[model samples]
Target: MICLVGAGPRGLAVLERLCANHAGENELVIHVVDPFPPGSGRIWREQQSPQLLMNTVSSQVSQFTDESIDCSGPIRPGPSLHGWLQSHDSDADQGRRGPDDYPSRRLYGRYLRWVFDRVVADAPDTVRVVVHRATAVALEDADNGQCVTLDDGNRLAGMDAVVLSLGHSDTELTGKERQLAGFAERHGLRYFPPANPADLDFDKIDAGEAVGVRGLGLAFFDVLALVMEGRGGRFVPSDKGLRYRPSGREPTLYAGAHHGIPDYARGRNQKGVAGKHRPRFLTADAAHRIRENPEATFRRDVWPLLDAEVRTVYYQALVAQRGGSSAASNFLKDYLSEPDDPGTLRRHGLTASDEWSWERLGQPWRPHEFSDHATFNQWLLGHLREDIGHAEVGNVDDPVKAALDVIRDLHKEIRLAIDRSGVIGSSYRDEVIHWFTPLSTLFSAGPPPLRVEQMAALIECGLLQVVGPEPQVRTDPTGACFLIGSATIPGKQIRTTSLIEARIPKPDLKHSANPLLCFLVETGQCRPYHIPDPDGAYESGGLDVTPRPYRLIDAAGVPHSRRFAYGPPTESVFWFLNETIRPGIGSMILEDADAISRAALTC
Candidate 1:
């Protein structure tokens, strides 16, 4: 029997691919384990709000690797909110003129559960796949095979391979984290975890209380919905977003970050493109041009574009100063007041760090056009080490020299940003605070009326308030915390507490989180951009201030012993470094119970 420890999309996917791609002459049997009732885990089975939608459109969500239905282009082309629901109605509602908006994550979860059921049905007669609706408490490898101990004190017999397709862990509220909980606990504080999309008990809170949110990221938007619209708040339209009216008394929202609010999100309001495209600020050629001479290129082209994107605000005595102007008659008011210059904002609003990244994405910002963009980031920093510039490093706990490494260089910039904010403070602290927040990435894709409406309804209902902006957010003293995106660990920081160890069925503990490492092994990437951690049974890299070892060795040659990590959960990147939350990717996980069974028998 092949044991698939976590039966979320990834586990199902690994099972499906093995079944579809392998010579299944020897029937495969899959022993799928999870605490949730079959089909999906808590992340998918629960944690959904009716109003909170998947970030991606429906065409992009599938559960198989080889069986993909093309999604014409990157700019959202698929079944939208109306299209999905229209299947129930007459054909007339299909073309109704409205926002072809995103749908709730709950609906997407339903899609995943359905796909899992279909996989279970199509397996060969020779395959015998049994799903255990119990938690896997312990796992260890034996010479004969792998032994998996379930929560019920029963140990499943030997298996050829074990796969961890787990999902996000419950947020273990720390002392300080609890202090945040206490804020909403009393004065009727409503707590919102950035990771969860579940419907919180916003009703426990009446209107007129000072409702505060811990992080002003996307989760904050979901919380904004639960209070404003989900409960009873009504949505009214506005240029900035949908305004809300309390079905009862409204509460003032207290949104605090180290930097108040981000300016990058909300998107550009420019109209009448230069030709057809929305201004080709950056493309592959732009990257190539900058590659020729990094510093000069940044000062002229790159710095100008990004600087225009930044929003500056310093509430010196609450005058609501914006971008160096002490007035805001309206969003359009500022336009008429200021001269129509292309790069003038770069001079007044853009700060030093802004200048730093200005060169990062380069003048032409078509991310899809360039692949080796990271090389440019390393080169721009003056190539700290001559022999190796921006190359990978190994060694878990050994210190890496900051003056000579790419990872070291990035980490150094992170530390400097943290320290500078601590001392002199960033010129555009509020902009940086908002940019780094989860909201920055989520809304970066695009925002529709539905989401903004949800927030507005909460406020109008007297259930939400517009707590003014913050200048910046600081890392935990150690900086081990992280910020997330949908399917990537784009952001990293050292925090007060981090995972130290993990226990998996296939006990070849290894660094599994670095997406690059996963791709190298060809085992599979973690579905939904997160490493599985059911029951917190996996090991992790220790929380040392110094950088841990990061390596990429051939899996076949790597020894499977206690001293080394077999696959993720043992090395520096154990559980997904998924600071970015991209849950919509779950539907594409394939399910093949038979392949898992055969792998258990042979490999």
Candidate 2:
């Protein structure tokens, strides 16, 4: 018997591969365990409100292996999310969703369920799949093989191997977060720690209450939708753009982050599902050469190549927009010969204003200081409007968006240069993890363009306000409320009794709140991955595992022969852990799953 823990997308991928590689001679019993439904698991469970939508378009997501995935196992072609919706008439309302439209999370959950059912129905006769609706709280070595204990007090014994595909999990609060929580509890205020937004109770916040939100990433967008639209407020088209119609049930929200701006809206999907930007500078061969150097750092080596890739795409689009295809070709030829020369661009009729830099784009607010909140707010609003305009122009047509989208497209090459000892230890900790990861995420992983449009409308209607850059949140004991201020805007602060942390907790194995993870650590079944730097070691807060099959490394530095782990839980071991499988791209998730399945079966 083989046991699969956490039946989310990662676990589902393993099951698909197990069947695909099955020899069909011996009987195979697979036990799938999770408290939530098998396919959707916790976060993507069908119970979420329909207002919460997926960040990816429907045509891009898939649950099955396809021709694009390079794996040793046999490919099992299946429908993409859009294709599945087209066939399922019962989902007529959602079935009519266009390829480019974002589907509700609940609808995606339904699709996951259908995919799970389909995988089971098509499994070979030799394979028998049993799903348990209970969490696997503990695992231990048994006399025969291994044993998994469920939350329901049942035990599945004599398992040949087990795979832990635990996705996003909650972690204990940090020192600052705990202090804030204590303050809120003492004063009868509401403090929401980092969490899945769908699980938060937004209704508990009183109407017209002043609420301070402490993150401006994707989670903040979800909170905005829930507290506004979910509370009966509506957004309608106006002469200028969108106008908010208040239901008087919305909270006055002040949201901000280090950058003091919402994430950039995703560029419009002019490229189809299979469309991709071919990298010229940041190619795999280039990355491999960088990996050969012992002194390589992301800033010193990788960023130059990545920057060139972005500039190449940006100027290609910009020149094409101005002087058409033939001009773009000539510009590319000259630009390739002298990538750093400004003369090449000027020769193509481009000015200094046309130059692109990732640093300026990533931290646009750095060069100026706002005297007060009003000045910052106006400046921010203009930035949002400009971002929306570029988004509307589409990723393919817009020069800026096309350039920024390179960060998304060249992720595989990026991973090749940074994941698992690709760079020096100090460089990995400081340059790659601390600096580059967040910057890339902010630039590439943003909400739908429509969401940003609604955000601008909310700000115009006075329902939402953004605190200035590098915001600091503190407990104002004198006022018995939370105070949020920005270092950039001195003497300006917003006070509120309700404070919501609109972000997910970073994965920390040492302080994981989940009983299963805690048990694993306490029992020495696993340990947290640590990154060594010249100064000191940085705790990665990810489960340490072997490279290929990803066997969980024990506390004593030994890989467990019969155990494996992947997905978000093994994030530091693998770069870019949170993305779903795209149909026509080579998927790391699928590759990892196939390797683990083959290893598990052989064991």
**Best candidate according to TM-score:** 2
For model 1, the stretches where C-alpha displacement exceeds 4 angstroms are 37-39, 46-48, 66-100, 178-208, 236-245, 249-252, 262-447, 457-462, 471-602
For each candidate, what is the lDDT? Answer: 0.37, 0.88
Candidate 1 at 144: error in angstroms? 3.4
lDDT of 2 by residue, 1-603 (tens): 999999999999999899899995899999999999988888889988777888899998888888888899999999988998888865433533789888888888888899899889999999999999998889999899899999999999999999999999999999999999999988999999999999888888999999999899999999998999999999999889999999999999988888778888899999899788998888999889998986678899999989888889999999999999999999999999998899999999999888886667877877778778877777788889999999999999999999888899888999998777677778877787788888887888999988999989998899998887788898896848999878777665888989999998878899898889999999998998876555666667789998898998999999999899999987776677889888888888898899999999999
Error of 1 at 233 (Å): 2.9
TM-score of each: 0.51, 0.97
lDDT for each residue of candidate 1 in 344-389, tens digit (9 for 90 to 100): 3343443344332322221222232212323322231222121121
Q: What TM-score quantifies how close candidate 1 is to the native fold?
A: 0.51
